[model samples]
Target: MPQNDRHKEREIPIEFDFYNTLESLPVDNRCTIIMISCGSTTVKINEHIQTVTAPAVLCISQYDNFQCLERTHLSAKVFHFDPWYIKACLNFENLDDSVPIDKQYVYDRNMLYMFTKHHGYFQGIFNLTPQQYIRLNELMLMIGAETYAQSDDYWTCRIRRMLRQALNCIYDIYVDQCKLNFYELSENSNPVTICTDYIHANYRNNISLNFLCELVHLNRTTLNQRFKQQLNCTCIEYLLHYRLKISQELLSNTNLKIDDIANQCGFKYGSYFNRQFTKYLGISPSEFRKNPTGYSVKESRGKP
Candidate 1:
């Protein structure tokens, strides 16, 4: 990785036939960064695998332990996500680890296949051909950049909403082109659809187990078990994490007072909000605002 702007911007170059294993990971506390792979590289993490082609921005957070299982022919450019530079509410400190093709997400092969088939179109987007996975990394960078560049809170929020909608369109194209493998597992009923709506509808309020049970028509036991089994986390965990993520975006992008942000993110009291933010993110809201460029977390706790 090429380090520029004093750890604020970086570039990684991966060459063909290159292989490396990060058996012992580094312990550096820095802000989250965007990586632009310059060439074909295969990355493996336990059973999960990512084969990169074309130039793609790989977002790495301070919260992640990137135990690189294996890699091949990897080269890329990397840049840092400084909250002050971008002026967004998103905390680059937390990273999202949800598997892309799981129940809560719709897998689209069209988007993947398009990149794989016509590698040229995405060549400019990524430095690394034969592009297999395209949307996730690219979209991440797009949102990151847009959030950083836009100052208007309303426009920033609107842009993120549209970006999500665009992601849905990409998913549609992907589903139309390639058959989703996970759909079969959820044939009897699509739990994700119901649960997604429930969370989105009532996330701002105090969403409890009984409430979710009544809303989804599932018992507490079943809901708990299936939620963890399918989505890899409990419902409440997901809700809090999601709320915090949105709050981060709001904090960096808007001039809303801390109390108002707390209320907007479903926290009744600003003190509780401060505690939660500090507990999960290592830094208080005030400190984060003061030095948006500082991206390291004191301890690991939450995901973005």
Candidate 2:
């Protein structure tokens, strides 16, 4: 393939799924697409390769099973997760990578390998050796186990958010290591990582640009400029979205009244909450809860 052909090309968004067939095997290089109907699955990849140990998302247009004996010598584990879950975790639509893929691209988004000709920071963290890949796969499964064990939509969302963060880490590694092409990013800075961590830590509080600037060690203008350039949103806009997302979880999981959920999500009045919720989420809290299995919180005897 020409260097251009090897370049990262975006594709149309397609319906993709994940599956595990380690119990069965494919005759080498037989392309197959694993379909995940729901939930996440993890597999070990033991084939060793000389690559750095970090998380990277992979894109698969097809799937194939590798033939391997059921022996301890095998060297790779492939972790499979619902494509929706992956998409839910990444705001791919708004990502500002130089080689931007179309939102409609249906390529497999795996955390395995990247095309060599593709150059960007996203390539850094996710591409890994078989051993390192196996370890990361195990960690993802543990997270999934904790998520399902809780059996609460609240925890599920939390886990989903965590998965998104993990994927973002892969992308961050890509951004962190790759040469700057379009964005005027700092030479040795991962501002998104810093800003997001701060946001999550103080999400429950009434956080603002001035406060976040102090926390992330950047001035308000620089912070605002960089976040908007990279994430496609201002700091405050992202916070509102984050708070609204939390409120949606609260409304669905708990029997808490609208006002209560609003207060808990940092809003002081039910009316303002209702307006914002309706504006962003496209439904009132009451309307959302009316869905067949909206969100029901079963009080856990203990936290997972």
- Which candidate number has the best lDDT? 1
lDDT of 1 at 297: 35
Q: Which ranges of candidate 2 are over 4 A from the true structure?
A: 1-189, 292-304
lDDT (10s digit) by residue, model 2, range 70-176: 22222233333334444543332323244455545323243322312232232121444455445446555555464335544354455556555545444454545
Candidate 1: list runs displaced more than 4 Å. Answer: 1-189, 293-304
- Per residue, candidate 1 scores C-alpha lDDT tens digits across 1-304 of 3222222343321111112223332223333323444444433322223334445433333333344422435544333323212223222232122323333222322222222222211211222222333554465455545444544435344444544543354445445433643323433234544455545544566667775565446788888677777766676766777778777877788899988999988888899989988887789998887776665433233232
TM-score of each: 0.36, 0.35
Give Cα distance to truth, residue 239, candidate 1, Å.
0.9
What local lDDT does model 1 show for residue 145?
55
lDDT of 2: 0.46
Candidate 1 weakest lDDT stretch, 10 residues? 12-21
- For candidate 1, the TM-score is 0.36
